[model samples]
Target: MKNVIFAGVGGQGVILASKILMEVAMNAGYDVKESEVHGMAQRGGSVDCNVRYGEKVYSPLIPREEADFIVSLEMLEVLRKLDYLAPAGKLIVNREKVDPAPVQTGAMKYPSDIEEWVGKNVKNAVFVDTEAILKELGTRKALNIVMLGILSKDLEFTGEQWEAAIRSLVKEKFLDMNLKAFTMGREYKETA
Candidate 1:
């Protein structure tokens, strides 16, 4: 089974990203299972979605340290979901920091060396400034699509398959921009 965990703050579009992945997996003829936790999402709380796909996926929830991939949309959320990564898991994380309630309230601290920590812990991790890319595109809502494009690199699905998934799920008005964002993300060189 391929287990993927998508983590980020409530508004970061992690849920949507997970949905796109699920659809793509299903389209590829994999038995897919998915679960989501979004308590207090509107208040900027933690949100995550677990997706499993294979010939026969039995569980929606990924066990500890069993995730094949963790696509994180925020810096601190990457830390929160680090333990879910398998020994050889790959991480695609956004290089953006969103302070949690405790940290914003001065009751807790956000780690200063998060990039270093992730580099030290994960065997294969790619960090992207997705926010900056989206901003340049004039639409931050496409961050999820951008992340999806990055993930498409590691999957067997074709660009047409991904575009079909996006076209089916996204609204008509925003389709062009989202498609643009996805292409930009797919072409990203990790150094870009």
Candidate 2:
């Protein structure tokens, strides 16, 4: 894989998601490098992370037009970063929208037609309602894990390897839920 782009609004665990993938890749013995832009970033602003891994990776930066996987934690941001996605890239977007608090509070702004925009721009889009899936799993906070579940399908690691990777990253307490989420995500590819 040349590059992977993880995009979403702030507080959506985009960075954590990338970290998990990075760890998994590294655990699989691949040279991995990741870059993230997160500072005073808030709920409404755009946040993204770049992860590049292979036998040899030179830079942590992922240039526009090189991303092979566009994994979106939020639907709109998928459109926000669409231009950076490679021509034949695959998109995995959470099929729900967490409109920024600004739009909800009438204190900020929001772009229009985000979902439709993404559809028009991306030819290969896989829509997964992460929020709903997590709720089905009996919690709303598991949104990130649920989305990660979808991403598992794209990884080149084995189930055992992925579990080990998750164990290496998550706290012992969050192990069960996270593992469940990851397994669900990893299975998404086989059945998708």
Candidate 3:
């Protein structure tokens, strides 16, 4: 089974991404199980989604060290969840920093070179600008869809399946725009 962990601050759609993946896996006839933790989510706290898929998943929890794929919507949160990633896991980062604490408090302790830091830790890491893509797509809310698209290439899923899942969860009027974001994310290039 492939184990995945989606981590990001609240409002980044990490939970939605996990749910979409779960529905797609179910549609594909895979046995899938998931778990989530959302402490302080309303204050923009961290959110984690543990998802697994295979012929028969026996446990809903992925071991703290066996995540096969880690999708991070925030750069530092990527570091926070790095320990859970398997040795061969792939890390997909949003390449954007969202924490306002440093600037607000004048602490100046944030990592200025996030890509370099990720390279040092993750075996495989891909960084992309999902925020810009969503904005260009005329919707700031589709960042999760954008990230999910990029993840699909590495996971056992595709844009079509994700589209179906989104349609099932959201209002019909917003489906087309979300689909567009998913397509863009799925087509993101992997850096050498």
State the lDDT of candidate 1 residue by residue for 1-192, as single tens digits: 899898887887877888888888889899999998755655678888999999998878999899999988888888878889999899998898888878889999989998887788676998887767887889778888898888888888899989988888888998899889989889877852
lDDT of 3 by residue, 1-192 (tens): 899888888888777889988999999999999988766654667788888998999989888679999998888888788888888888988887886566558787777887986777666888887766877799778888888888998876666677788889767887888888888888877673
- Tens-digit lDDT string for candidate 2 (1-192): 558888887777778788888888888889999988767775468888999999999889888888988888877788777777888888888766777766799896677666676677677777775554575567665667667767776667777776777788888888888888766665554222
* Residue 80, candidate 2: C-alpha displacement in angstroms: 1.4
Candidate 2: clashing pairs of residues:
149-185
lDDT winner, 1 or 3: 1
Q: What is the lDDT of residue 39 in candidate 3?
A: 63
Query: Rank by lDDT, descending?
Result: 1, 3, 2
Stronger candidate by TM-score (1 vs 2): 1
lDDT score of residue 122 within candidate 1: 73
C-alpha lDDT score of every prediction, in listed order: 0.86, 0.77, 0.83
The pairs that clash in candidate 3 are 149-185, 149-186, 150-185
Q: Which candidate has the top score in lDDT?
A: 1
Q: How close is candidate 2 to the true structure, as a TM-score?
A: 0.87
For each candidate, what TM-score against the reference? 0.94, 0.87, 0.91
lDDT of 2: 0.77
